[model samples]
Target chain A: MAVYTEVTDEELSAFIAQYDLGAVLSCKGIAEGVENSNFLVVTERGPYILTLYEKRTRKEDLPFFLGLMEHLAEKGIACPLPVAGRDGVALRELSGRPAVIVTFLAGMWPRRISPQHCAQLGEALARLHLAVGDFRMERPNALALNGWKDLFAKSAERADEVAVGLRTTLADELAALEANWPADLPAGVIHADLFPDNVFFRGDSLSGLIDFYFACNDFLAYDIAICINAWCFEIDGSFNATKARLLLANYRKVRPLSRAELDALPWLCRGSAVRFLLTRLYDWLNHPPGAFVRPKDPLEYLRKLRFHQSVRGLGDYFLDDSATGEA
Target chain B: MAVYTEVTDEELSAFIAQYDLGAVLSCKGIAEGVENSNFLVVTERGPYILTLYEKRTRKEDLPFFLGLMEHLAEKGIACPLPVAGRDGVALRELSGRPAVIVTFLAGMWPRRISPQHCAQLGEALARLHLAVGDFRMERPNALALNGWKDLFAKSAERADEVAVGLRTTLADELAALEANWPADLPAGVIHADLFPDNVFFRGDSLSGLIDFYFACNDFLAYDIAICINAWCFEIDGSFNATKARLLLANYRKVRPLSRAELDALPWLCRGSAVRFLLTRLYDWLNHPPGAFVRPKDPLEYLRKLRFHQSVRGLGDYFLDDSATGEA
Candidate 1:
């Protein structure tokens, strides 16, 4: 729901002149992404997405995101491929913001996360991990354990405004996560922000994945942990174990999980929860009151974090019978 | 930049089941139009616009709007035609808001209004006035002189907050306009809000016109006057007489304006300016400061009104030679 930079018709006409795509028919600012101005641009050839990277999106990280999409798409993964202009460059500038045109993918992101969607998402996530294996770019997860403490420091003083003793709870969680974080657990390029909104579904099948701005090299299973918290929780903050089982089971079917990865699942889930909670807390405390974007409730992730803390072992998340033979 | 009503995928799928259009490919909330939640809905058939009318749009007015589009498109006007479902119904309830799907029109609304656009707009407007002659439904302009006084009354107390003597200027202008408002002018279904944003052009050709929520049976000359105020004014508030003459001459090439209509142009322009000024003033004063919508500056129209006030006669708007042989 953001189009921060306005692109005039004259600017757009000149900008599109660098591209081989037919004359711009229409360029509509889409109200879907918060980080950048996205337009569902239609031309004589077909519909494409024209994105102007806003202030929040670092210009340096764009090549990594665009390169990863190209890498993944080359491996037969369904994702948006940046359309190169006549000058053979995929990225250019428009409205003083880095702009790129990408091929449009068909399908809507599933609003209701059914078990079937979770199952498909699990397989897709595993395949994505396998697909980007040989890619050479490297970007560490910025919201992982390394960055959590700094984010917490900013929002620490006023954390209790959201809830009683929330600051202490976040501090305790961050301390525990930092002390016990796993050193090695099969690192690879992961779609670190694989929320349901980033996965598109056409009917019962998954069509593609999008929003690779958050993609980076991190623990592959940590990506699964993000999905566990994102997809397996209901509106009432109750964990749907069936969805977790389906997601984990289907994920294992494509790529076997190591014993260390299995052992690290609980802590990974907790860390992932804390990661989102910190970001959400920062945004909730900092965003101007009555802003257009309704800041997501951080407490929802806190409740899930508490749920992960209560889990006794791997058995709580995955029964032995549901396991597809972990490594 | 508004999608106040959220339409779920399940609801949309079920809703589309009643129509012949194939499965929903995608539905992105478009950042356009303040009155409705507009989605650029794509299906296997083609692209279409799904509009969910918000609170500002009265439920009773849906039929008239949809009916007019249907009538206009049937008469070969380049406007979005309402796409009826299998039951032959164009208007239905979705997310508890009156909704309709209309055919998608290509071409972006001109951001920079050129004289060519003005010429095309004038002829198109004249054709639109002639095309809707047989439309049976009748709706009086809700923001005409009848409604201006009430709106002014709402914001008159706070008018001085915007300017030192805006309140008195507004009152005096309202009085003069009430006394001198033309009577017995030719009236038809007028696209009363025909700003540059509502008219789309493709490569110097007028592609289509949109946003009919403000359309009603109003003075045809007043519609031209609204266009004159909208398209002929530069960013600095100076009137471009060349653009106005081109617009007027091209309009006469289609439907010649009567001498009374031509003479009433200056007054109609002044009234139109007042109509927009009063509404914008009301919105500026009454709208929540931190609300999502940024209220337009009413003083812009105030300046336009002042410009119209300084005009000596129709000659000030139209020069000697391009007078269309006016009496």
Candidate 2:
């Protein structure tokens, strides 16, 4: 819930004049996306999202995020298409920040994660992976293995303030993940942060995926692991294997997973859990008093990490019979 | 910038099912209106604002607020008309709070106010005063003279914390306003909070007025005082008399102001200043640590009150020659 930048009427009119979108009807600051200021801009043409990238999103990375959305949409994936100006440039400056207007997608993100939602999400996730296979842009996941260690270092001294043994637990997990991280797997562009809120749905079908700030080139199975942790968990800290089975099975129907990718699922899931835990821990310890956004509970990820640590093999995620006829 | 209530997809669908607004296509929480949870809901029929009344708005007052909007819109005023459900009821319950869908007005509030904006605002305000002359429902202003005492009582002990001698100054001002507040001077329904943000404009023309929760039965001149304090002050605490002259002159073109209302303007402006000062002081003192909405600086109103206290008559607001053409 953020609108960090305030766009004035004159500045907005001048900005919109660069585009073919008709006279501005209304532009409202929307309470979505924490990384930038977002406005639900309506014009004589229709509704579009005008985003002003803030300091959190590096200016150099705007091309990759904007280009990835364009490439994915051109490949028939359901996502917001960046609307370029009359000069054919999608990215421009507004209020001294990098800005762009993208066509608005129509759907509400599912608050209650149903098995059907997981199935739809699984298919969309696989399709996004396959769509971006040939795209030339490449951005390494900044919050990957090395980034986790850096975040832990920043929060390690005060980690125990959140939980009594959280500091030691994170140290041990970091060492274990460092030694056992997978060497090679099917790699492509992955939506590194595919939380349920980022995936919108219309009824039982997936409508679109959004917020590509964290999208990067990484192990595709790692994206699946992130989803299993995000969508397959209940409020009470229990994992629903049925949802996981549907997600994995539906994903495999579109793109088959290699044997090694299947075997590395547990480690990838654990790494995913630790990645979130470290970031949340860092935020929890550092968020200023009276901050607008309440930092999420880091212990939730700790609980998820414990579950993934206890997993014996792929069987723990779902029964072997659930994967019948799959690679 | 608030969306305090989270309406689920199922809850939203069920709520919209009560209306003729077609199947819900999208609903996004908008950062508008501090008092209620506002959503920009787009359906097959287009856009509307689905507002879930929060705790700050009393449930019992819902009928007066909703009916007033309906009444004003029917009288040809440019405002959001309340949309009734199929059952002919405009008010219903959503997320355990009284909710309603209002026709979406297409305009943006002026971020930088110009004298032309003030002129248009004055005309719209006078039209609003005339439109509500015959409305049946009545609600006394909750933040009027008596309410100011209650709010000061809550913050008197700490008023000095905001500024030296503030407590004594407030106590003396309250006594003076109690002695001088006009009686029997053009009373009717008044939009007591006509801040610039509540008025919308398209280019140079006034499009509509909104946030009617502050509407109530009060001295019509008091509404003018509120607007004077809101729209006539520059960001640097200086008053713009040219804008004030344009506002009052244009307003009189629609509905003439009585000589009594004109003479009472200075004291009414002082009272309006105290009204906001006490509420802001109370909020500043009582707000919990880490509150989401930062309490506004009470000193801003203190400066405005000081300026109004120094004014000798309407001449200080604008040249008397400016009102020569009007009553």
Best by DockQ: 2
Cα lDDT for residue B160, candidate 2: 93
In the order shown, the chain A TM-scores of the predictions are 0.97, 0.97
lDDT of 1 by residue, B169-274 (tens): 9999999998998998999899999999899888789999999999999899999999999999999998998888888888888898887888888889999999
Q: How many clashes show up per model? A: 0, 0
TM-score of each: 0.95, 0.98
Alpha carbon lDDT at B268, candidate 1: 96
Q: Per-residue lDDT for A1-327 in model 1, tens only?
A: 777788888898888888998798888999887788999988888888999998888999999999999999999999999999987999999989999999999988988889999999999999999998899999987888768989999999999999999999999999899888899989999998889889999888999999999988989999999999999999999999889888988889899887788888999999999999999999989988646666789999999999999987888865443234542
In terms of TM-score, the best-performing candidate is: 2
Of candidate 2 chain B, the 10-residue stretch with the lowest lDDT total is B318-327
Alpha carbon lDDT at A104, candidate 1: 93
lDDT per residue, candidate 2, B225-324, as tens digits? 8998899999999999988888888888898887788888899999999998898898888888865666788999999999999999877776453334
Check candidate 2 and list the clashing pairs.
Answer: none
lDDT of residue B132 for candidate 1:
94
